[model samples]
Target: MSAWVFDLGNSRLKCAPLGEDGRPGDVLAFAHDGRALDAGWERALPMRIEAAHVASVAAPALRVALLEALSARCARIGLASTQRAWGGVRIAYAAPERLGVDRFLAMLAAHSRGGAWLVVGVGTALTIDLVDADGRHHGGRIAPSPALMREALHARATQLPPVGGHYREFATDTDDALASGCTGAALALVTCSGEAAAQLCGRPVPVLLHGGGADALRPHLPDAVHAPALVLEGLGCWAQVGRTP
Candidate 1:
């Protein structure tokens, strides 16, 4: 029997089948507009899956809808939630529940690689987390993502466009300036966080980038590894343990 894992984020919904080794297989993604999903989207899923493991940071409406759809096609369903510790990763949060499941999952995936890491997720938000080689989560930071920053600026100023324009060190036009500023802000945060993580962990850490907006920043940070399926990869681990929250 084959199982599937789902990662429902603020802007998109991603899913993948579990492989024989319990890792995620080819991933499929769909844009989420906070509306009811259509039958065509549902048809894209396997006709029948042995089980479904979901890690959702989306609104309740979409979460419930996706679960309802999976219930009919899956023998069992597992929902992921933040935990103090899982698979070797020890979260630093005093109240584990306050931590985002997506962040926790990304940390889990990073820890599984057996090294110190700085996990960065760039989507609706920019999230940074630090984990030592022994799986001790040092903590993390969150701020508006580059796209969100651009959107907020456009919303407030009206003169600035939310999208388009390439990033430059010294942008000449308004559009390019907007792009450079927002993206540079995010990069600065990541850079500062990396330096702090190095100090706290007593060594430099590798950066693992994920989420929808990661690509936009990848060229700037040449050392970071792009792992778009990171959340799903963590969900795969959650499924393997047969744990639900």
Candidate 2:
């Protein structure tokens, strides 16, 4: 049986189907505006999908729409949550239901590979979550993404110019300096937060970074493993649950 997976982040909606091997196939992405539902998504839906799984950090309305769409295309539809336990990881969020499903899934994906891990998702917002070697989630931190931070600065300050370009490591002067500094700040927040969590967890956690901004932070984070599709991998794992003996 095939499975359809959707990861609805604050910025975008990513969808894909899983093959029998539990790997993503036929991936498609749409803007998270809710208007994209009626667009050509039907054409993108695979045939013979038996189950559907979704992870969303958006409004309840958007989640409902996504589930309705998937239900129309599949026999079974499921919503992903931070509550599920997998491998050695057990979620420790004070309000597990309030925790972002994407963060939980990413942590699970990191843990599946084995070892203490720090999973960072850098999208509309930057989130850093930790999973210890014993599979216990030690919680995490969240901060504005570099883009949001830059935009906020430009929006609030009249003289500050809007900056746009590839994030560089070393800035020769002020222009590159500001851009690099903003980007560096975001990366530092994530790294420092992860490191702190690792220390609290009493283990050396290997960092797994994901999201669109991951590449920009990679140079500064020599210790981090880049996993662009970490959330998708987690979605695949969620889709497989309860399907086997």
Candidate 3:
């Protein structure tokens, strides 16, 4: 049995099929503006798709449309949520209903990997989630992404130009001041959040970084491991469990 996973985020929709090894096989990403599913998906759906799972933070209407399209292509469809319990870890959100499903899914993947972990997702927004060694979720933090930060700065102030460029490790020089500063701040927040989560767990926790901005932020995150397909990984995990009973 094969599973298709879709992670619909604020800016993009990422879809992938999981192979027997639980890794993404045919991965495709599209903009959030209601584009058709990739042609590959059309060809792949007939190849015995047993289940489909989705996580989205899009508007309700858009989410419905996405789900409907997915339903047309698969036998079973599961909506990912922050409220569900998988294995041992349970979501600890103050308002679990309001928590982004993507964060929850990512944390699920992180917890499955074992040990204490801080999962940081940097996309349109920054999400930091902590899972202890005992598989207990410890809540999380959210903040504006680097792009959102730059946009806010530009929108609020008259002097600062819209900052655009890749993040680098050394930014003391003038040529990369704005880009470096923004990157540095984002990385600082991620590391600090990880450190804080570790402290709360009473031990050091490994950091798993995911999302679009991860590559750009990599230079500044020395202790973080880049796990680009975490959402898909979680989806695979979900699919595997669904088959058992």
| Candidate 3: residue 21 lDDT (0-100) | 73
Score each candidate by Cα lDDT: 0.90, 0.77, 0.77
Q: Which ten residues in a row have the lowest lDDT in candidate 3?
A: 35-44
Across 153-218, the per-residue lDDT of candidate 1 in tens digits comes to 989999889999999999999988988999999999999999998898888888999999998899
Best by lDDT, which number?
1
On TM-score, the stronger of 1 and 3 is: 1
List the candidate numbers ranked by TM-score, top first.
1, 2, 3
Clashes of 2: 1
Candidate 3 lDDT by residue in tens digits, 1-245 = 66778888776778887788766776677765544433444443555567778888877777887887767667888887766567566878667787777887787788778898888899978888888888788888888777777777779874666765555567665436667777777777877887788679888888899998787687777778899989888877766666677
Q: What is the TM-score of each candidate against the true structure?
A: 0.97, 0.87, 0.86
Cα lDDT tens digits, model 2, 1-245, are 67777888766788777777777776677765644454676676666578878888887887787787777768887877777466446888667877788888898778777878888888878888888877888777888887777778889984666675455678776557667878888877876877697678776677899987677678878988998778888877766654656
Residue 19 miss distance in model 1 (angstroms): 0.4
For candidate 3, give the lDDT: 0.77
For each of the candidates, give the backbone clash count: 0, 1, 0
- What TM-score does structure 1 among the candidates reach? 0.97
